[model samples]
Target: MRPLLVAALLVLIWTSPVTARATGSVLSGIAVEDVAWDDGTALQIHWRTKLDEDFRVLIVREGTDGLMDTLGLFPANVQWVVDDDVTPAGTYRYRLSVFDSEGILVFTAASHGLASPHANWFHRGRLGEALIILGVFAMILWGTFRRRDIYLRPIGGLSAIEEALGRAVEMGRPVLFSAGWGAQLDKPTTMAAMNIFGWLASRAASYDARLLFPTHDAVLMAAAQESARESARIEGRPDWYRPEDIYYVTGSQFGYAAALDGIMERQKPAVNLWLGTFAAESLILAETGNHIGAVQIAGTDSTIQLAFFLVTCDYTLIGEEVFAASAYLTRDSMVLGGLWAQDWLKIGVAVTVIAGLVGTLLDWDAIGGWLRGI
Candidate 1:
């Protein structure tokens, strides 16, 4: 009977399924890798394990002193972690320690190979953005080489410049142009205003109308003088360019507004052209122009002052219309090509936004993820 029982036990032991024993140090497959396409400031740690909520993973990195330093404590189920506190081109190794539900040390593992981060020339994540930028530049080159008439939407404020000058000529009153209190030659709005000023100066010279430009900035005053002089020279009427007309007023914001109001009231300009940057004084100047019954044409990038210009001025160039004024008026191929590229970019952005919205609605994560450069 003892021999028969021993044989049955042996058969049962051999027939049972072979399973891995839950040894205390069971963590395996630890790996350390470089973070890809970054500035080389990070490393990635990966491992494989079957752990529950009650277990925790404690990661450590080899310090400069050759001792392990704690990286972080993580949940047991996590497969990977990013260590951003690494130096570029520096080799790193990692160790992971597992703790059981009772907070007792259970398992330990170390990465087999060293990993070092290196910077990539281009970011892999922003590939879509890079492609879009390249496409924009390509479109710009195409527009430049083609040199066709790039049609621009006509701006009412821009179109009314000649008419405003005509009214000034008819009324025998000077056409007043101001770049407002915050005017600076370095500013885009001010530069665009100067471009418009050049065109207006040329037209004013042709009509033999007096064009007055009062500036708040001395540097802007200098630029205006040069632009006015060049425009007059181009029109074969350098004598019409008055250096005194583009003079600077007080730098004080309210003081400048007061001086402008005095000029507008005393000179009684039939045409008032307000462009460039403005502050609280925008309403004051526009109101004064409206009170004097001048044909007020205004353009600004300032959102708050836009409402005042819209209400008080006869014609208002909204937002980017001011920037496009030079290209629209001059029709220069380079500028027109830039505008063309800008339009194409805008179209691309709009299409991308709509596509992302549609993709989100349909639960297609790839489209939205790509759009977000993920």
Candidate 2:
């Protein structure tokens, strides 16, 4: 019976697959690789196992001091682990050990070569976006040199600036302007508002209209004063520039709003130009202007305040329209070119999104895959 059993076992071993017969080592294909397109702080450890028995993997790294530090003990089912604790441009060596259910080491392996983390200069995944930006830059340069008129859609809020000033002139009332309490001159929204303010100051001087600007920041008050002075000089009405009129109000948000409301009530300005960043006070100011029967033109980058402005103001410049005001008002070739390039880029993005959706619906994975790769 023992001889027969031995013969059966030998037959089973000989006829079985090579993988089953080659169970001397439970682990195979152990490798270490540097993670790509990263800031050079990670390494990936990869391995494979054929054994189905309950086991765990112990990963260790040899430091520069030649001391082995155990990374962690992971389940056998985990095929890869990312070591983000690695330093940039540092060499590393790793060893992996396979242990059985009883914590007995079964097989051990090491990376074939030394691995070092490196920082890539450019991200390959964003290559498509880079190309699109470069194309837009080239278009801007071409448009700059061509010196052709770039057509821009008129913004009613911006177009009415002159008409608002004209109404102020007709009514013999002041044109009140504010850059809001939420921002300073350093903010882009405030700077954009300053651009519009400069142009409005010049026009106000030309129309001999009273222009009042109040601010919640001292630096912004100084900037507005400079802008008004410069505009007055440009319009050849330096006497019309009133530095006192462009004054600093309190820094408190609600206090500033209340002061503006009082000004609107007492002065009864015929036109109100509210631009820049605003928060809760947007509704307070706009509602006051509406109550006084003023022609209000408002603009802001704050989405939260935009709804209030839209409902209360006569005309509102939303989002990027406020940024485009300087270019639209001045008609500078270079600035207009930037606007054109931005529009074209938006169209391209929209088209790409539609194509990706269509490809997904048709079960054509190539288009979606290419877009994701980019």
List, residue by residue over 1-374, the lDDT tens digit for candidate 2: 74463344334423553232225767778888888998888899988887654777777787565755567777877888998888885788887766677655566667887888888888877888799778888876775566668778778988888888888999999999998888787798989899989988999999999999988999999999999999999999999998889998899999999999999999999999999999999999999999999999999999999999999999999988988998888788877877777677788779978988898899987867986676
lDDT of candidate model 1 versus the reference: 0.82
Model 1 regions lying over 4 Å from their true place: 1-25, 65-70, 101-103, 149-154, 169-191, 201-269, 277-281, 333-369, 372-374
After superposition, the stretches of candidate 2 with alpha carbons farther than 4 Å from their true spots are 1-23, 51-54, 65-71, 75-78, 100-105, 109-114, 150-153, 181-190, 217-223, 239-242, 247-252, 365-374
Tens-digit lDDT string for candidate 1 (163-281): 88888898999999988787788888888888888888998999999999888888988888998899899999989988998898889999999999999999999999888888899
Model 2 CA lDDT for position 35: 87
Best by TM-score: 2
Query: Which pairs clash inside model 2?
Result: none
Whole-model lDDT for model 2 versus the true structure?
0.84
Question: What lDDT does the true structure give each of the candidates?
Answer: 0.82, 0.84
Location of the lowest summed lDDT over 10 successive residues in candidate 1: 5-14
